[model samples]
Target chain A: MTDTSDLRSPTPDPYLSMDLLRFTTAGSVDDGKSTLIGRLLYDSKSIFEDQLEAMETSSKARGDENVNLALLTDGLKAEREQGITIDVAYRYFATPRRKFIIADTPGHIQYTRNMVTGASTANLAILLIDARKGVIEQTCRHAFIADLLRIQHIVVCVNKMDLVDWSEEVYQNIVKSFREFSSRLQNIVEVTFIPASALIGDNIVDKSTNMPWYQGPTLLYHLESVYVGADENHVEARFPVQWVIRPHSDEWHDFRGFAGRVAGGVFKPGDEVQVMPSGFTSKIKAIYSMDEKLEEAFAPMSCTMTLEDEIDISRGDMIVKPNSPPEPSQDIEAMICWFSSGKTLSGRGKFLLRHTSKEVKAMVREVKYKVNINTLHKIEDDLEFKLNDIGRITLRTSAPINADAYKKNRITGSFILIDEHTNETVAAGMIL
Target chain B: MNYTITHLKQLESEAIYILRETAAQFEKPVMLFSGGKDSIVMAHLAKKAFWPAKVPFPLMHVDTGHNFPETMEYRDAFIKEMGAKLVIGSVQDAIDAGKIKEESGARASRNGLQTYVLLETLEEGGYDAAMGGGRRDEEKARAKERFFSHRNEFGEWDPKNQRPELWNVFNGRKHFGEHFRVFPLSNWTEMDVWQYIMAEEIPLPSLYFSHERDCIIRDGVIMAVTDCLELLPEDVPEKMTVRFRTIGDATCTGANLSTAATLEDIIAEVAAARQTERGTRADDKRSETAMEDRKKAGYF
Candidate 1:
């Protein structure tokens, strides 16, 4: 058994025993995004001295009045030199309550694929809108992508309030426009608007003295306190076995366990379950998280489960409850965000599809329609999905894959398309 | 009791997920162990990942031939403890075989030379995936590195043309000669690693804890006095209570004077410390794009 005796202290340290919150940042290219992220990190006291010193030097070299907070997040050489956010740069910070992983995604129209990739795993998203510009096309597009990705929380930070003299009229105007457009967005459960200045550091980490009009939680406070525990699908049980652990040792000779992360729902020690493909009926014998026997294992918990029956199972096999099992089918209808650069996804293209822990040969069966991201209108007759294009498509797999609708359970329903030729992740698909 | 996992437990689960993925996806995989805390944590996770079953993949140490004696001792004990097979890719062997030239004088280091040997080892071992204990929080350039970093046949990393790794799914597709340098610890920060070590009671080398050791100051950084580094006339060796933040080639690895004797002490030290963990490393201070330049040329 793996030793975990030292982990149990006399008293639980809240700071060390806290959870994590992963959030994504989306905004217009020049919406002071880097500055806002920089502000959050700096005010949160996560920025190290060396990084801050480097940012200061870069800001001096760039001849900016204030240290360019954006410089901290713009890690790549090309991105720094070009003064643009190209790729998604992940930033880390922690408070007494929670640890945050900020996915600083690019906001350009061409980088919609990057935005989608960032939001794919995020629980929350921060949509930055320039106070002067109000709710523009970029704001709507970010909100649409956030909604499409089913991000639970959206924080609308109406930034650059310093330029507008912290006027409530401009802030309310932007908030009103955002709410008007955002009301149409689906799946975004909570929407929050805060007026702040990224440059002068208002309403980010500390309470803003400038904004007596704003009375909501600070961006950092909300991030730490946001309820993400209920974001997963707790109704249907799903566990895709990623590995099988068999000791083959004398001490524990007959230890055959199916190891995987719980994709959805709760699994206890005596739950009646059925293995996919084989349809072998079994009852859960024991659930273990590295020697610690658990009463139950829920979504996202990596655990090993031993069954009452010795059924043959592999990496791609899934273990689900007898009730409301995910539909198994060879044909899959999905919305794919094409990511292949310089390579257009044509109809009838063959690719390797990976779902949960399943990987099978799949071919693009049909290209149904392309939806214009800017207008959110479905375009028919246009079947081609080029680089950074999101379109509806149908696929046929070589073998049957068990999966749920992407909206119902993001873990089991979502998959990535791999180009066997180039071996690159060509697209991210969400089962419809 | 809260069944929900904490950040440290969550990180452990995520690391295990990546390890299992590497084991399942690749034909031949190896864990890059260096006797460092990060690699030690990686090895421990590998144990939990395939509990009851011995670690499926072997451990490969890209020996710089400039290691602290304690590192080798810890490595041998760990290998024995885990019953893991050890494959050493020696820089000294390459130097002796004339496969690569050795650097001389103050700037000479086997630290950069390990890259070539690492690539050679991968090709020779027929390894399609080499798991490293690298974390993105260590360096700026590493922040953009994907969990499954693809390298061409020539062992080159194309930063601009990297794949987008989404969700828990990792695409480990490769050609005949190409392989992947997967990082199971990509998202973990320094505090998280120490916190995890404290939580799991993972054993590390004594060198990590503060001890009285002979050291010499170079570039305002205290480096342990070892055979790997030839001291200059002005360099004076001093006995001080120093511990290493990162374990690598002793020649370039700087030591910080501290009394962090226990895991709890280390965690407190890490939390209160202002500079980045890599701030003590002299190898990365070579240039602004030192890590980037080396990464492009296939450095883990």
Candidate 2:
């Protein structure tokens, strides 16, 4: 009994007080994105001894100038052999301030799908730029995708400062150029700039003494302190029914609860809500978060809600505040990013569209225009939406889907197009 | 007012969402239970995902026949307590049927052979989705794993051709004769699992706690002295107070010298420990790409 005391009145757990930050990194192999991530993990003491030992052994065998940090992320055999990252890899690290999940995405033009996939879940994006080359085509392309994904925060890391002798002029030039370019983008809300050398370990986790002239929060500091709570839409109440809980057992015979994660706003018992697609009104009876009754629930919290009335609701139906109900329509206009290389996006192409918990058959009605990712210009001439091409298209669904504009709500506005025949995710769309 | 929740709560919500998605998407699904802390947490989350109702899927265990007796006892009691169905895939039966051959020598382990039995069990049971406790933070290859990992008709994973998983919307669509290995714990680390276990008061096997046991030191690893392991020339048996960081095949799972009798002590030990949790996993030490290779061939 005395030994079990630790499990009972345990002092405050360090993890319970910490928050979480999910950010994605965008850059080419030459931009030292891997090294920057490695330095952050290494300096923060997240890299364990066994992993470091394995990395050292692999580095020696490969005959590299510094234990190639790229080996830390390139997990697959093909990626290691070819010295490139073919897919998005997730890495975790934690500080006293917050726990961080890094979506390490490759920078090649062909792998734009990976970046888009990584950025889709991230609250922030880290754009890496080489000091020698201030701002290039690759930089603009990465920034455009991040903005298109509606990533609220962007941290421009000006790396490889050791090669330029920690020049403040080069960092400022890159920052100015990036600011000028990002001003034209639509959805990015905040941007931060930092000067550092990933290989030499400057300004990543610790404050660098080398750059006495530069003054700002370190990369890790900024990440730990950034305000991403406002990123979630807390004004519009929306809950998409994912699954219905029905217990046939005698103990819970009459149990019928609608389960889902809150996509936007706050919900509480006694709130009036309207069921979508079949306009029905009901009052929230109770909210349960894993058997524990909650006073209130908000975005990103998975819970079960019981309505006052027995409404015919299933997985595809949504419950929202009656005043702010989304417009239910069969026609949807969206910005599409084609992901499948085997199949190209063409007009009148039919695919399965998954938005929220609803699966509907949709047909591409028209390809309005394609955007050249490099120049961030509307390329109306080339309507051919090939792999990794961003374009605007009109889609008509087999059924009416109640959706909000992407700018208002990320969860309700975004959708994915699945190839009907191959079952591959062909494109990601943001409702315009 | 602060609108943010703690990291633990956030991770719990995310995992619960994935578990609910699995229950809704697949006709037949199962949870792979190993009686380890990770699996214990996963099962606990599953119970919460559909409360007032029993877990929709059965809990499957691929018995290597080289497990600690304590593990078998704990697994049976856990299943009975959860009021869930249990399914076991026996590796020994596969070996007897000539489906897989047993390895020879002192370092022989049935870890790789369990994959054959697992795949066969899934085929026979007609389960289209198998939810595992595999975490991305555990190994290098797993770092690239998706929440809904697709496997072909041959039950092989194509890492390069994995579908893009974006946001909380998990694409679980698969063709007939194909299945997906869903990992609701993909974002969790070993520390996160332990912390959640402590917070949730999830019951685990007694093997995780410190106790006196017969052990042998091999290549700087404290291998438990079990009947299934063949003694090498350098292997010497001794009584030591040791605990396992991970629970796997008894012949391959290594123990660490510790006195962490409670969850609190274990958490403190893990925080100060210098090595990864899988560092003591003798199976992963077989080769550089051991886990990756095993996963490609359909290992959970």
Candidate 3:
């Protein structure tokens, strides 16, 4: 029998542990979001026999002459028939270097909310443009959404190079136009351009034999090589306590650890920390994982922390560095991505606002402006924010909230608005 | 001191953060524990999420009473070890009291019956939030699931009207009688889960590893011939060296041929496996969209 106690501290092999990469894919109906994902899975050897068999069966049933690469990601039957992505479909694959989560989002205007939801947490967004089309309105819309969501890295894959006879001028022109447009968006930090065909497997996973003009790394190579370490907030120490861990067992009876994942910065055992809302100060006693205690914990680590002094702390409460604390405010000015279809979000509508671990009643006080995604301009006259629309809004909450700017901290700076009557999520907002 | 977080660790942190959000936001919350690896991992994360302090909520298992014996044993011991409360809503009890009529046929399964017991358990416990180990990578319909999934009074999931989950902010707000099903492991894949389990060194039931068991071949699936499973003359019982890909009712949950004797070996096996774990599940084989249909009916 495997001893239960011995199972707690088994040594881990780091080489076998896979790294995760969260990315978003954007493409018009014909630009091949599904084909690119299918190609990635196919070439990376992530596609399974059953999935391929299912694809083959579905393709045959649909009376298609060839395997529909789009069928792999166009999950909904409606989407498969319509030849468009109606909603965001998340797909997972892994390479030796990194495990990937692709949020394949629709490129149309109606599904912009889905794009926003997909891009919000993504570190990188793969914006696909058909080489023949150059830069279209849909391309601009997707890029604008990626920028609005504060996605740092943008890989502009100029797809279907095979269709365009692998023209370098077309690729360069598209790249220049995307750069010019992206320069206007404040959130986009880095943009890389690659010319490839998702259908023929050119520069997707392997070097394209046809495209001798292209010298950049393959799409898979770029995805695996991109430095995502700077993606997280390492400037501020934010630990939102998920739960208070107090094992009543005899061995750990007196342990009072604050269980949470570190959202930003680095937290050491001896670092002085302040509990949010209550404003109580304490020093970290220990940072414990499942098997052992650690001297320090950094951003994106879920570990239990014990304070030197017994401070009253609970879930929704934050532990941060004393010197650089997040501003606690009841009035929040934010950019809201309206998602509900019931009614347009207007001023002074009561809703539930969830920030980090805390939820409180909030009312939208004012609509500052609505963003015209295609034009990249703000329309102030339109006070009504409808579904799939991005707008600026002011909110007043029932209680004070500890928050940072969405740019500074993705974890503490974001919130969602829930409809009180219907209890549906109405909007997603980022604190400005 | 420098702390480096692996990709799986980052995902775990995100999940723990969501779990904390559920506990903090909801008035009363409980975790859905099915004795599956995902649920086991979720429970482990929950324990780590609120370490030093007790997990703020109890664990609810909607027991169909047709589970693998090892699963029940593991569940009981694991709950006891974690010092977390475990609440079981028996489908057998529901059938005995006539709350739900037991299906009597070749296709009869208590799988659909567990949803009623689960919903009733949540209602009785006043649990406004129920944490589940659901992941988007599991099926096609689950691809669009929100981190905080809302359910109506009848516990039906309206896939058409899902809440938009942006960033790490989860909306767990619900009215009385309604509840939210929160999936912290939404971003995690099958390999990620196995790797995390291996990295964290979490204990699992022996059935997950290669074991000799008397199982019957029915409908191209190896169903464990337990007391809970009714066998017909057509079903041929045989002893095989097989391991369960997923643990559910002994009748529907299928086993895979494997030589994996250790956790590391199992992880390697899963990493190299060509098909998804759900490919072995007979319940999902009922239709092309069987999982979707069940999800719509509030079957977690």
Model 2 ranges off by over 4 Å: A1-11
Give one digit per residue, the lDDT tens place, for model 2 in A1-432: 012324466565666577899999977789999889998898887889998888888888888867788888998889888999999999999887798999999998889999999999999999999999889999999999999999999999999999998988888888999999999999999999999888888888888899999889889889999999999999888999999999998988888999999998889999999999899999999999767888889988999999999999999899999978898889999998998889887789999999999999999999999988999778988788888999899999999998889888999999999988899999999999
lDDT of 1 by residue, A220-336 (tens): 888989888888888899999999898889987999999999988889999999999788889999998877798888877889999999899988999999887889999999998
lDDT of 2 by residue, B253-297 (tens): 889999999988898898788899899998898888888999999
Q: Largest lDDT belongs to which candidate? A: 2
iRMS per model in Å: 2.3, 3.2, 4.2
Expressed as tens digits, the lDDT of each residue in B230-295 for candidate 1 is: 999998898999888998998989999999998777877888888888887888888777898999
Worst 10 residues of 3 chain A by lDDT: A1-10
Task: Tell me which residue pairs clash in candidate 1.
Answer: A247-B52, A247-B53
Worst 10 residues of 1 chain A by lDDT: A1-10
Candidate ranking (lDDT, best to worst): 2, 1, 3
Q: Evaluate model 2 with DockQ and give the value.
A: 0.62
* lDDT against the true structure, each candidate: 0.88, 0.90, 0.83
Q: Residue A171's C-alpha lDDT in candidate 3?
A: 86
